[model samples]
Target: MIETVIVVLHLLVAIGLVGLVLMQQGKGAETGASFGSGASGTVFGSQGSGTFLSRVTAILATTFFLTSLGLAYYASHKASAVQEAGLPDPALQVEQVAPAPVLSEDVPVIEEDVTPVPAGEDVPPAAE
Candidate 1:
């Protein structure tokens, strides 16, 4: 149950990170525009948005990394638990398949027998 929750949270954070990164304007966005037009005069002011967005992105990225590590650890632990409880380790198990049957020389093989005709005489025509 905890693993499931962590996975869901990790996915949400990843999606949010993608959206936030895309929403922020790149440094080169205002190269051709007037300085005034490029200015952000809102609550975040000129430099606040850049710093705030970057900080939030970092936090989300850290969370994503932690969740990934956690999931890996949990999976390994669960597999070990199964082994400790006497259940077979699927990776270590080998299936016993039957061997193929061997052929023997005792069985007789059929062959065609023929006699050559003498070369000088006219050969008799085969009857229909």
Candidate 2:
């Protein structure tokens, strides 16, 4: 339950960061206005330092970073829990492992002979 909440929060923060970054004007944009661009009037009244956007963006960025860390923590903790339960770790499983080779029925199986020869009996010759 907590993991799900963290995941959702992480996604929301990521989207917010993207939107905030896109909405912010580049530094070069302010330079154009300084050259007398027909006496343009901005929302901050010719720029009374609207650091509000910058502060908000910084806060959102910090939240996004924190959410990312939280998600990673939850994932690692879950993986550890699975390991403690004696089940195979899903995160450690590799899908690209090669399988053991299989032999056809035509192939002979070589095994050690376990039967002992009785006393006074002629021992059979070993196979070539």
Winner by TM-score: 2
Q: Estimate each model's TM-score.
A: 0.60, 0.62
Total residue pair clashes for candidate 1: 0
Residue-by-residue lDDT tens digits, candidate 2, 32-113? 6677674356565554234767888899889988988888888888888888999997767879978899999999999996
Model 1 residue runs over 4 Å out of place are 30-40, 90-128
68-114 per-residue lDDT for model 1 (tens digits): 99999999999999989999998888999999987689978788565
Lowest-scoring 10 consecutive residues by lDDT in candidate 1?
30-39
Candidate 1 at residue 114, lDDT?
Answer: 57
TM-score of 2: 0.62
User: Backbone clash tally for model 2?
Assistant: 0
Q: What lDDT does each candidate get? A: 0.84, 0.80
